[model samples]
Target: MKNIIEELFYGNIDTQARGFKKDSYLQKQIMIMSNSEEILTERLKGDDKKTFLSFVNASGIVLGESELDSFIVGFRLGARFIYDTFVDNITPYDDFLKEVNNEG
Candidate 1:
């Protein structure tokens, strides 16, 4: 099997394709959002419909940017965790928690 990094680099992995579970909160919310969008699109007319679509498109762009930022931050956080595990010599999570809580 190829390495995960190579798989990702070669476009074999699609992280975003792992969607929410059926009947999950996120799934329910996505359904609600889709229904609301359909209803709103049907109701609006002329310039109002155009404006609504433009707003939605702009919001999608902003959300995509935010998702990218969050992914970068989360990746850095995980890297830092591994770096800390090796450099700080705090092997046990319970000890780390105790130190954080000033119980040590």
Candidate 2:
């Protein structure tokens, strides 16, 4: 098998291009959100509409950042699990904290 790092470096791994199955819960919710946005946008006008849109865009940015943070945390946790499995067992919180602090 080809190396994952090589594939990622060559732009072959597009993690951002995720998809949801048709008629799935996520798809249904996305449809509902889109419909709601269209309906609300039609009702809003002038400054109110612009303000609402700006708010929506800002909220989306915040949510995206939060999701990225969560993904990073989960990835780190998975790596930590693998480390614990194969490496020397260092399960104590104080020991972990000391090692982390020493790294910095």
Candidate 3:
């Protein structure tokens, strides 16, 4: 099984919702959290935005939350089975490691 962090940037980590902009910190957090099933979101049900996506990656049921609920963070991609190129061993983790500006 490939690492979840690798999958995400490799386009493996899919989400039903993507309106949320991809943040470096958020990506790292998601990658680490991928080890488990549950994920706490930074977005909310309705604050001052339009209809949002119900899920993200691997379609899962949301438990619900005031700030952000457990969003889907995984899904089986058809490309991996159908195409060899899709199943890239050189995952996003490699890229992340290279350009990781660890300055906060």
User: TM-scores of all models?
Assistant: 0.73, 0.76, 0.19
Give the per-residue lDDT digits (tens) of candidate 3, residues 1-104. 88978888798665645653577787877767663433334343363222223444324433344224323222234445546575556654455654666642
Candidate 2 residue lDDT tens string, 1-104: 58989998999988789899989999999999999989989999999999989988999999999999999999899998888899966554557677789999
Assess candidate 2 and give its TM-score to the true structure: 0.76
As for candidate 3, its clashing pairs are: 14-57, 15-56, 15-57, 16-56, 56-72, 57-74, 58-74, 58-75
Off by over 4 Å in 2: 90-104
Per-residue lDDT value at 48 in model 2: 93
Q: Which candidate is the best by TM-score?
A: 2
Highest-lDDT candidate:
2
Question: Pairing residues by index, what is the TM-score of model 1?
Answer: 0.73
Ordering by TM-score: 2, 1, 3
- Candidate 1: give the clashing pairs: none
Of the two candidates 1 and 3, the one with more favorable lDDT, higher being better, is: 1
Comparison by TM-score, 2 against 3, better one: 2
Ranked by lDDT, top first: 2, 1, 3
